[model samples]
Target: MSFIKKRTSHNYDIYESRGHIIGRITLLTGLIFTFLPPLFLWLVYGIMPPSKELINGIISISSVMLPVSIVEILAFSPMLGTNAMYMSYLTGNIANIKLPSAAIALEVAEVKPSTEEGDIIATIAIGGSVIASEIVILIGMLLIVPLSTKLNNPVIQPVFQQILPALFGSIGAYYILKEWKLAIAPLSVAILLNLVGDLPTAVTIPLCILSSILTARLLYKKKLIKVTD
Candidate 1:
């Protein structure tokens, strides 16, 4: 038993070490590619925004996105594990697509998050989802010109708007059903906040996460929830 445990730990450590090295290389490559289009325009066309305007543009976008990015990293890292996090960020759509796919994969595989097995499963699931989404996007792009009018119809527009909410709601429902006690605090907070006013996701998500963590801790201390290995 000791030998098996040690071997598993060793393997996991190796996986994490390699994952980090690969992740960094891939992310750096992606970053370079991301700047390529702007670089091309500047070099070939000599077309560039004024320095002041560029700075302001960057600041405006960053002000909104930086907080959300930080919050997402904190909230998602544990569930996604290191490798999956790298891939999800690179692919984009972490919240709407990668996250749900990874979560559902974990649930289906009966693996707990933050474990070696869970990390491996999540990475695979995310990769698959990325491929699937790309294929769908390709198809959509091809069809969009032809279908633009139909897609923009008011009835269809409403359905498109609801798609993300429906996806999240379904996943949330499953988890809440499984752990209703743990859901109480966070769910209530989310609902109350929605009723009170429109809060940015960066604010509401972190608060809900904090509330859930505290509630879980309290429940565990009171012997209201069981921890199983």
Candidate 2:
């Protein structure tokens, strides 16, 4: 009845346990720091926020974000591996930076995600990515005024604007093609949802993930997609 899987490779289990223990500690530390500013204000300055307002704000934000956060944790952890999860979450910006970096590293290493080798690669990738991103941010901040001015130029604006879409599209396209059958249901449903109107992204994301999982299951059952033992 252990949450961590019992692996034949004791080293793997040990590594996973260590990672989870550290990750949880880091997560808790982060949560405490996140509320530190408000707590400091209340204690030191007596600038206490209204409890009713705080409750309402928490409810409003959590209603949209909490479920998405849960889904993200479940969906990304296996693919990212435990150490990578700790690194990526600690640094923030997973989808836009850490995920793509880890994916590329795994692809380059020819390692399957969720495997021991993948865990190492993911940890390295995320760690390296976090370092590189921080360096880039530091450099960008130093030249912020000049960089912002240049980036805002009409000629340069479109490139900056499309960067996220382009990056995700290129990386995502490869996986989508690799598992086209699995992609079809989710893609179609997502498109339909978009056409219906502006659905909250939190709702859209989990729905798409659920649809993709269901489609994959059905396809496997129908023998359209193979499930290897």
Name the candidate that leads on lDDT. Answer: 1
For model 1, how does the per-residue alpha-carbon lDDT over 1-229 read when each residue is reduced to its tens digit? 9999999999999999999999999999999999999999999999999999999999878877888788789889999999999999999999888998998999899999899899999999999999999999999999999999887888777788888889889878877888799999999999999999997776787788889999999999999998766
Model 2: worst 10 consecutive residues (lDDT sum): 1-10
lDDT of each: 0.91, 0.87
Clashes of 2: 0
Residue pairs with backbone overlap in model 1? none
Flag regions of model 1 displaced more than 4 Å: none
Q: What lDDT does candidate 2 reach at residue 24?
A: 93
lDDT of 2: 0.87
Regions of candidate 2 where Cα sits further than 4 Å from its true position: 1-8, 41-53, 152-160, 227-229
Summarize candidate 2's per-residue lDDT along 156-220 as a digit string, tens digits.
77887888889889877977877788888888999999999998878999999899889888898
Task: Give TM-scores for every candidate, taking all chains together and pairing residue i with residue i.
Answer: 0.87, 0.83
